[model samples]
Target: MANIVIIGGGPAGYESAYVADSLGASVTLIDYDAPGGACVHYDCVPSKAFIASSEVVSNTRHADDLGIRMPSPDEITVDAPQVYNRVKELARAQLADVTAGLAKTKVTVVRGRGRLLATEEHGSHPVEITPEGEPAYTVEADVVLLATGASPRVLPGAEPDGERILNWRQVYDLPELPSKLIIIGSGVTGAEFANAYTEMGVEVTLIASRDRVLPHEDGDAARLLEDSFTRRGMTILTHGRAKTVQNTGDGVRVELADGRVIEGSHCLMTVGSVPNTTDLGIEEAGVEVDDGGFIKVDRVSRTSVSGVYAAGDVTGVLMLASVAAMQGRIAMWHALGEAVAPLQLKTVSSNIFTHPEIATVGIGEKTIDDRDMDVRSVTMPLRTNARAKMAELDDGFVKLYARPTTGVVIGGVVVAPHASELIMPITLAVRQRLTVQQIASTFTIYPSISGSISEAARRLIEHDDLD
Candidate 1:
């Protein structure tokens, strides 16, 4: 059996180990933290736990809207400590489950950081493992997979002190909720935090360098989210970039480039992420990284070196955890001479966890317009759907895209409560190249939000005929 060594125990590395092991390869997975990576330990799992609690708070506050009586509006309160504890607990449980699975799969787990050694140093073995407080060792590998993941991007002046100023990962460690929270960068991360905190009754201010929040998302979806944030009394600073963050005795101050200074009890930075590729001896091993320090990998996750491969956020190719796992599996399969398929980015679905979630799948409008592709689209409001009305959900919509002539679904966007759940059918349609007629003809439960999807698909078919 071939020996496969994977660096970094994030989704990509851990998943790659399992795949290779199942295929009869001897695999060793190495990382400092528990196996699940940042998605479980920091970003996805923990944040979603907080979001879920906030959702309950939101639902209770709006219970009166559904003719359900509560004791009083003022009496409803969210315990911040409990919320933090819950997030931590869930993250720990998830990490435990992942590590347990890795153990069961017979993949050797190395508890330390792994780095590519100099070609000469790795005369026989290409990788070196340095465990904390332990002697260093080398691994003889038939193939080396790099899944080092990424870290939160920090501005030069806006350094996180982990107290008054924070990164997304540090927010979960707060002892108590801030009276006023300032979030820098209004991308998906910033917007989700803003939405979650607003629901949990924390005053929030969003700093957006762009004209609107989630500038990369669909225009209509961004506008809807902005409107919701405004309705919830969250302050927004647009077209202004955050220059620096400084602790001011009791709180923190954010200085904007436009001669504006904002004060908040705490600030959360959601700018972006930097790949964890530095000091890994990648260049020494003949692996190529881009100008941004991200590993340059092909669709199958092969690095510049024939026996070396890379995946996940380290590759700077779609930073989603699911994509990381898929890329890792593809890398191992390709290396093991097993059947493999290159990644098709357009088929991937991503979700933003906000009060009214935003989920998108397949090609977006910008891509189609840039490619000059002929397509037709139709959008149906969730408010118009029976289930949405019954649940008192009046915001958001379902938008579908299809080829003008063939009626093949190409992409879709959903904005609604549990929009993530509703986007799967649309994602399947896009991935399977299902026609608008086929989607419309599929059976949908009566009075469901999913019915809106089918209804939108039917409308797309009608509009295509008219064009």
Candidate 2:
């Protein structure tokens, strides 16, 4: 049996450790925190927990409009501390469940910071981790999986003081929500927080360097998001270049490159992320890192080093929780010399947790623009869908892009309630390259949100308009 040492407790490390342990490999999972990794402990789970509460509060405010009467409090109250506690409780419980399962396997979860040390005078290097207690325990194994996640990007001038200006990860501890929030970046994370907080009654201003929100998404989808955000009272400044953020006595003032200034109670720097690769001894271990320090990996998740492998955000390939999990699994199979499939991002589904949440898969306008592929798209507004009208939701639609000749779907987008769920069928179709006729033929529930998906596909078949 091969002994596998998985570093970092993030999704990539924990998932691969679980997989390797199940495959009868002795696994040692090393990290400073518990097994749930960043996604569960700090990122995905906890944030979603907060979002759930905020969503409830916002939806309740709109209950009467839904023909449902909600009990009205003279002055609605928000117990932020209690809400935060619940978020932590949910995150902790989920982590405990994952840790419990690792017990039966020969998987050891060690708490420490690991480094790759020079091997003995005769062999390859081994991972050296300094345990957090007296007389640290050192465990060495043959295979090493690197899943150290990424950290929120802190710009040169705009460092997260953790007070006035903060990263998305630090917002969970905020006792009082921002009265007016200025999110400095119109990326996925930026838009998500803007939408979520705005729904929770925060006055949100989305500052973007690009012309519109979600510049990387389909043009129609981007336009829709921009329109929706504007309708929701979001102050969107296109071509906005935030220079410096100064903490004012009352709030914070952001100086733009164009001499324009804006102020807000709080600022979220959703700029980007930097892979956590420094000081891990990655370079010393012979692993090739990109100029930006992200570990260089192939489609199969193999780094330059043979015995060592890297996955997830560290690889810098589409930093999503789902992508991280898949990379982890692929790294293990390839390392173990078992059957493994190369990473196929063509089918990877992504979602922006915004107000009219945008979920997409396969390729989009960005792909078409860069690759210069001749594809046809059919964009149908949800305003025309009976289900959307009945639900009183007029803010989203389904768009499908296909290869005109073969009628095979190459990409698609969905925006609406449960858009994350609604986009799955389109993602599957794109991944499998299913024909527009195939999607149109599928039985869709009457007056359902997903019916728009069928409508979009059918339109593509009928129009034959390739733009």
Which residue pairs of candidate 2 clash? none
lDDT for each residue of candidate 2 in 1-467, tens digit (9 for 90 to 100): 88888888888888899889878898888888888788888778887777777677766766777899877732456677888889889999999987887776788888887877654444444777777784555556677888998889887677787788899878878878888999999988887788778777778999999888877777777888889778767899989988998878678999989999999998899998898877788767778888888999999888887778888888899998888889999988887778988999989998877767788898888879888998888788888999888867878888888987788898888988778899899988977778899999999999898999998888887864521
Candidate 1, residue 85: the lDDT equals 92
Compared to the true structure, candidate 2 yields what TM-score? 0.94
How do the residues 388-421 of candidate 1 rate in per-residue lDDT, one tens digit apiece? 9999999899999888778888999999989888
Q: Candidate 1: misplaced stretches above 4 Å?
A: 120-125, 464-467
* lDDT over C-alpha atoms for residue 209 of model 2: 94
Q: Which candidate's TM-score is highest?
A: 1
lDDT for predicted candidate 2 compared with the true structure: 0.83
